[model samples]
Target: MVFQCQRDSWARQFTTQVVSCCPAELQTEVSGKKATLQGFHVILEDTILFPEGGGQPDDRGFISDIPVLRVTRQGPDALHFVQKPLEPGSEVQLTVDWDRRFDHMQHETQLFIPGQHLITAIADQMFGFKTTSWELGRQRSTIELDTPTMTAEQVVALEQSVNKKIQERIPVVVTEFSAGDPEAETVRSRGLPDDHTGPIRTINIEGIDANMCCGTHVSNLSDLQVIKLLGTEKGKKNKTNLIFLAGNRVLKTLERCHGTEKALTSLLKCGAEEHVEAVKRLQNSMKLLHKNNLSLLRDLAVMTAQSFKSNQPFPPHRKDGDSEFMNIIANEIGTEETLMFLSTGDEKAAGLFLLAGPSAMVETMGPRVAELLEGKGAGKRDRYQGKATRMSKRAEVQALLREFTSHQSTEE
Candidate 1:
């Protein structure tokens, strides 16, 4: 179960014989779409590829030119999933992606070992805060401390303390002990898995801390480059999550933030430092403009309604408005005697309609007009309103309303 990867984390290439290869399927994403990948599960006699475990992702590499999509541990064997299969007992060259492996090592060091230890020590010693739990993410990580909140000043001090340790370049040593060894109790452990049957491994950071871990890690504190505390967020119960980035992640995050600042400067037409104030001013102006526009629209609605004759059937349509505006016009015109059909929207797209008049006439014509406009609506008393998708059929609806009103007057 102890693979070559765990024995020699620096190894990049290895030659091994394939033990078994079987047809398998991997669920993966391609071009932002979920898809099932048809592949083969290959087990090699020995491997340099680290399987996904201990909060670290699997290594990406090639097995004799065949791309390894994923590597996972099944029981005691590391399974390499690939598109093509190799014959059992065939010798193959396993090549690890060094850049990706190093990045993962840096992340694992900060997320699982050194970072957690540093935070726990400083928080408990300096602030009397206890770490409850932690989580590892691909780009960033967080350690939850048993505190309701962490002050900005405390965060700055914590970050400084962590980076100071990194500058010291403390050596990180990995030591293994037999399962029943008494020395194993000295290393901080959260108990082992029930199925575990190997020597216990502990990572020691010079005189700072020692904790049991199975993840790949950097050899020294200096390899982490720097630890950037990205503030904190509320966690479950009375806990606070301190989010952070380490090593190359810190540099990448700075680059992305600088790019965003440059874009904001150009868009706001101001210096980077003044971008926040500039955006606030623009938002205030927008609010005032919106208020004025609504007043003008209501004024227009009243004028249009007042221009209609009282005894005649009124059917008015607008290409640039909504259901609320149509209802405004219907309310101003008084829909008791005169049958009214009001609509507002683009001819090529969806719109809104309002039919208001006598209760009997509105109930009778509401469904017919809604059907013709390819919409659904319900009414109470004399008002019927709903959204319509076929605003282009406005002319047909107008004709239907005119004929109905004319026939009613003749019958009366």
Candidate 2:
């Protein structure tokens, strides 16, 4: 079904009569103005909202105090989706989210003016690149160059030229061209639709370029304010996607970069300009510290092994003088296979490593210790390693090792 079209320009709010209200089809993901169709919708006789079209997003605001989720075109009518549907034939307020609309407008203008002109001046007209397509968004815009890659100098030159044009403050002019007009040959787009008749909208940036477009545009070049080329990347079919930021987005990018600089400066304990050097120094210091720590742990392991060789109690464990306390050490001590556990936070719980010297001892004792400690591990030749939850079973571990050693001595 087609709805009658009404003539309206860019506006923020309006008092419009509701034409119809209906339930959204169940789970039908349809998009009219390129925006997802969602929720219940109401069609208004006249609306201030711009239906998502011409590569710009739909307006967001309230209709009779019910916040519209999204606005999209259904034939010639603008369908406003909302949680609460309005009654047909009722008068309601239609408003646009000014900030969001402005953002989309700026994005659209960027592509129409500086974005298109820059690519034409650089890739094709000058450097011989066949143009493909371009896309614009809230945060960034990407223009595809015909070939997959561009030279570093070309990218730099393109960015510089575009920014220069934006700063020139060239006037933007929008005009209508009648069908079969001589100027129609100048259109960058392939001729208008077959059904297209009457006058076509043409946007002209004074002395820069002109193209047929139906999107909202800025009246002046100064409205764009700033244009920043972020970088270039490979896109579909070896096309070079040049990314950039325009208008308020440039300022937003600066804000985020400043925040990142401040964080880096504070984390590295250095001035903003010296953050890189400070980070390097920190990395070097960490490497040195790691080396020293490993040396200490190795020395401790050897000393701990010596204590086991002698009749000494294990480190970090209670040695009751009244009883014959035993030392159960796991380390490379004169070929005696034992599981060497590295200490973590809790000395009473599982240590870091469950290392042993011999495959037989580790294979037999690994699962036994794991079962007693309610943990698990794997055994290799001459070594077994894993964590144990039965950390408090230090005495049990010591008794098991002692019994194994006694039996070994008898067998020998």
Candidate 3:
């Protein structure tokens, strides 16, 4: 059987206080040219305030006595949702959060740095510039110059030019324009959408940067404080990637770097400048010591091989340092008649067996011997190596080898 559950539609409704208002106050609903706070409603005659849109944050400010919490956009209407809802049709003075708005505006206006640009005929009327993205992370910003692409040298030159403009403290002028108007031509030529119903806001910094945008901005370039171009990378074929930091964020990053350097110096027991050299020296010494140890084991294996008796297999045993010694002995024998078996007795025992016998003997019985011992082993041509988690007794290894040789002789 299937069961269905009903969903409540109005379960998420909330009532909030309208604290602050935005400049979009012009479209606010009002009665008799007076702002009233009757019901939870706000009415305004006209407003120049901007709303949050296109990745830009909403303006923050206080309205009357209440602070503006957030700015929401509904259709073409920018709704300034306040902390506390005000009465409808009540006459009241409105204020905007200018500091936050100005910061957003400054960030958006700084997009037009001089550089190489490209114009692409994407579709019928849709054209996007293949340009460099200068503003990254916090705000992904890009600038499309008149040129298609800039060379590596050209990019360096453009970077210097943009930073110079930021330092010059050029004033950022914000103006509005309508379609068919002369000012609107600037917007049209740049391939930006024209707003004929109302004035289109344009941000221009004297001969340096100009673009149409609705985000809040700073009044002057000096307010930017500092501009830092971090790094650049290749984006699309004709486009480049640019990373940058501005004002307060850059200062904070500098402070973090200094702190990290101090910690590293204390841990490494060396000055910051000498830390890298000290690490390299230590690594080189360790490598040399490892080579010398391997050489000594190779010499010991030669002496051990000479002690083996003819026609008898050696039982494997693991001592504190048997693993390296066994491998060395296996290498020294390098014969087709001798088999080496070694093991060690510890809390957790282990064993290693190496076989170098008649090719026929190993081929027929190697797999069976490995299986009976409850271990894993493999053979190639006339040789085999087996490893056991628990060491095998000396008699067990000898019996397996004897049976293997006898089975091969019988088959022949």
Candidate 4:
């Protein structure tokens, strides 16, 4: 069934022909100064977007300038949210952001939890602890244990036993066959559907853990860099979350920490070990200096206000470029009014602003002021600040402020 989009601005309705062009139709919403966009919700007749199912993350993508934050399947439909508005009925192309998707796919494919390890360990202990459980987590495989509790001593012993196997460079083979005997050469792992019939897949890490699994895995045990056991905690009744990292990732993380330490030491002009203390001392000193500066600025503002009131031959000097002094005065006074403050210096860009005040100036004409400025900003009833990037003429800002004040009075 094909549906055409129609516009009803009152209904906040916008239409596009994206549904016919691609398998997915995307929607977007944009707002504010930083222009932080969030939305690219795809509504497709049918889609490839996977639901948050089986401990896997959703996909992300983009359309035009809009970034798709998340893609999820609702029943039979897929919804995509974007950062900005897209034209209705326009055939816009869509692309899935693959970096995130690939990482998620890799994680899903390599969930190497420790069900088989625990079971085999139990069997081995009963039969004289002859078999070994390799450190599967070291190879980029996420491993979990099903047992409720294991002591620190036991974990250390297990790790030692597993690493010994890695030094042996064992073969990890995957195969499929009919399920029959319990004491066969292979065993069934988890992740199989409930309604299974014949060809069950089995993973055999020779002289180590062997179980059935349908997930993707690397061929050799040596491909795993090194399984460094981070920590472990007891789970519901008889399960344990064995937290660890695999292979080159752990090494990379350690290297990153070392690099950060060196960079921070150089930045702080201190030795690596003294960096933290130096930073803390510098922070304390800066805070004290800032307080002193603020006190001086407040005294100057009071004196300046008095001069303005008394007409003490103080010329309205154009301050530094970007009018940092004007901003300072606004912050200090904390007043909301249609106040016109100007700063002039040999600067390049004319940064024009339609600054709103705490009083009536912002309440009525803030939005209209922003629209006139050819820039975008929004604020509450008390205060607002918007800029005119293109308004290079110094007189234009004064003109807009005057126009806004005049229009505001007439509207009132």
| TM-score for candidate 1, residues paired by index | 0.86
Query: Highest lDDT among the candidates is held by which one?
Result: 1
lDDT of 2 at 398: 67
lDDT of 4 at 262: 84
Preferred candidate (lDDT higher): 1 or 2: 1
Evaluate all candidate structures by whole-model CA lDDT and list the values in order: 0.84, 0.65, 0.51, 0.49
Query: How much RMSD separates candidate 3 from the native structure?
Result: 14.9
Poorest 10 consecutive residues of model 4 by lDDT?
1-10
Task: Give the worst 10-residue stretch by lDDT in candidate 1.
Answer: 110-119
RMSD of each: 3.2, 7.8, 14.9, 14.6
Better of 1 and 4 by TM-score: 1
Candidate achieving the largest TM-score: 1
Q: How many backbone clashes does candidate 2 have?
A: 9
lDDT of 4 by residue, 1-412 (tens): 1111001101111223344222334333446333344344556433333433334455555554556666554443445655455554565545545444444433332343334433234324433332211233223333345456656776676566655655566766766565664454446444544544446566667766676654334455555545555556655556555555545556766898899998997798888889879989999999999878767755665555455446632214343323344455455544544344333342234343435355566656566655654666666655565554444444555576677667767997
Ranking by lDDT: 1, 2, 3, 4
Residue by residue across 215-277, what tens digits does model 3's lDDT show? 555666666666555555556555555555566556667888789888878887899898789
TM per candidate: 0.86, 0.67, 0.47, 0.48
Q: Least accurate stretch of 10 residues (summed lDDT) in model 3?
A: 1-10
Q: Write the per-residue lDDT of candidate 1 for residues 1-412, one digit (tens) a residue.
A: 6788877788999999999999999999999999999999999999989998776789999999999999998877899999997999999999999878887777676545333465566667678877777776777888888899999999999899878988999888888898889999877777776656667877777877788877777789898898889999999998899998888888888999999999998888899989889999999999999888888888888877877654434646777677767778888878789788888887756888899999999999999999999998899899988888998888888899999999999999
